[model samples]
Target: MKDFNLSYGHWDLYHKALKDEQRHDEKVQEAIKNNLAHLLSEESIIMTNGEGMARLPVRSMDEYKLRYGSNDSSQVGQGDGSSAVGDTIGKLPAQSQGKGEGAGDQPGVNYYEANVSLDDIEAHLFKDLELPFLEKKENGNEGEVEEFIYRDIRKSGVMGNLDKKRTLFSAMKRNTIKGTPGIYPITRDDLRFKTWEDVRKPESRAVVFALMDTSGSMGAFEKYIARSFFFWMKRFLETKYASVKIIYIAHHTQARVCDEEEFFSKGESGGTICSSVYEKALEMIEESYSPKLYNLYPVHFSDGDNLSSDNNKCVELVKKLTALSTLFSYGEINPYYRQSTLMKVYEQIKNEKNRFFIFKDKQDIYPALKHFFSVKEKATS
Candidate 1:
């Protein structure tokens, strides 16, 4: 007779597998973060309008598992040797498509796409972004955000909102007052319940004017890139602000205030006049969105092909806008890196509040967003 001993290492196996999975997830997260710009520029995400899933393609790192009789030659694609020359014989793995002898050397397409919700994407993105300069508004809606706070302790309220700790303290104090100080039994009168009140948290009320040039020079690529920036900007504003408003202005040689749909979709074959949009923005501000009550943000996107005569007017309007606006910015979509006449003219306008950005490709959209909206840190003394 032979003697044998057996032991089970189930926990060790489980631990190793768990660690591998965790590492893989961390790797995927890093990849997603690195490629966030590309992901943000995807047409699917930009057009989603904050609904549905945003699929992310991430590479898998787990080792393939094998099962008993799985992919068995006897049961899979194998026949009784009576097959025709041209007959189909099932499919082959992508990595196994080559007919070269010996082991294959080419890399396999091992990546898989994970569905991430729009809210998740927004959370990952908006957590790091905020308006450049947000000022407190004192006009309507005293503060920008309303928060419900539970601080007041009442004698009569719902049982679910009972403040047990406060009630215990009350009971102890009452017992102490009654000369039976130590750990006395609680009474109905000692019961305390938490009450809440709506608090208006102080924050800035902002109105953003999204101005875009819809000239023929603003081709499909330029339009898409511009829209991508505005898409994220709109989402960011909605996610972070409760009372903030965004006005859309689209212009070619002429400027017009239209609905969001017309702003993004309308195109015209005409000259480019960058100043018209700025004038429209100022008009809108004077008409409804007051600079006193609203921290104005006027952001313009164009191909920088404005008429030479209008350049000075654009600069003057921008200066006027900067006087009232918190932060005024310009984004030029110059794919060819050509020195736009308007860009050259904009460079002459010297003001801390006036900032201009140039993006040649879609990937630049994320960095542009960060640059335009990143929260500025206070100076340390």
Candidate 2:
């Protein structure tokens, strides 16, 4: 069997195409329209250009398909068609059929896998859209090329306008008059065109703050799990978003912000109050990050060894933290003890899935990290 793998960008394009195929179904189309009315013309806000042209980003999968998918049988679409070809188009002979060899009591592999081309995907998303290609020159000036061009009729006069009928005759006469003029003819700067640039949107930035306890009770094994969890989270977050802010906080009796070196390297022996860790995180956000714009995520690790009286105050601080964050997640790595008072407080959160989490041992770290990012809450929807 052949193994297949695709990059993140490739997966994005694949899903975009899958979405296009599903849009053609009427039931799917209606459901999409009802749910995504904000993406439609009537419900969406239209931003107008300086030339008074109202523009909206392409949001309809069906519309994108018609303009750029397999159904688009235009000249431009045909230019970049798929290369996959089977010379024998008709049915195969019975002997040549390897169906029964692999078949059991159930039916065998009857479905044929159609290889879709990348051109087909690109066509569906970029059809009728003006794509600008920029080439930087040695002198620092940029040269531009447009995939499509149109000449203005009024400015070019009736004879030299974009009309196919009159343009040829006007061009012949104009070239003859200029080409023979005292060996000094027209320069290359005579062309006048109105070109628009393709607007590119900026990638969204997200920050994931990992706060871990280095208290003596955390143990070496628990620390290993916590560090491994942070590494995995960093890799996964980097793949998903363009920029990721990884803030590490190590707390023993007290908490302080630390860099990547001190995060997994330092060890301590003291009491724990989880609230101090959160307080530092809150301060970091207030000083630099804006809750409204940034995708704030906080993941904390501890052995649930915090003081009993601070549990209620810790819960209150978490509630305050949620208002200033996109999501708040807690990972309690209780190594020796069966359960702790701090774990009980976190487990009782109103939105337990979104704002809180609990883990018992080192084995739970991987699953806990996965669960933290995988929470699809009603608020996020």
Candidate 1 stretches with Cα past 4 Å from truth are 1-25, 52-54, 63-110, 137-142, 149-197, 377-381
List the candidates' TM-scores in order.
Answer: 0.69, 0.47
Per-residue lDDT tens digits of candidate 1, residues 39-146?
A: 788777777665655567666666778777555443345767888898776776655468688777877776666665566567668888988878776654444478
Best candidate, TM-score-wise?
1
lDDT digits (tens) for residues 106-169 of candidate 2: 4333221222232222222222221011112233222232233443333233333335433444
| Cα distance off (Å), candidate 2, residue 67 | 60
Clash pairs for candidate 2: 68-123, 68-124
**Model 2 TM-score on a 0 to 1 scale:** 0.47
Worst lDDT 10-window in candidate 1: 7-16
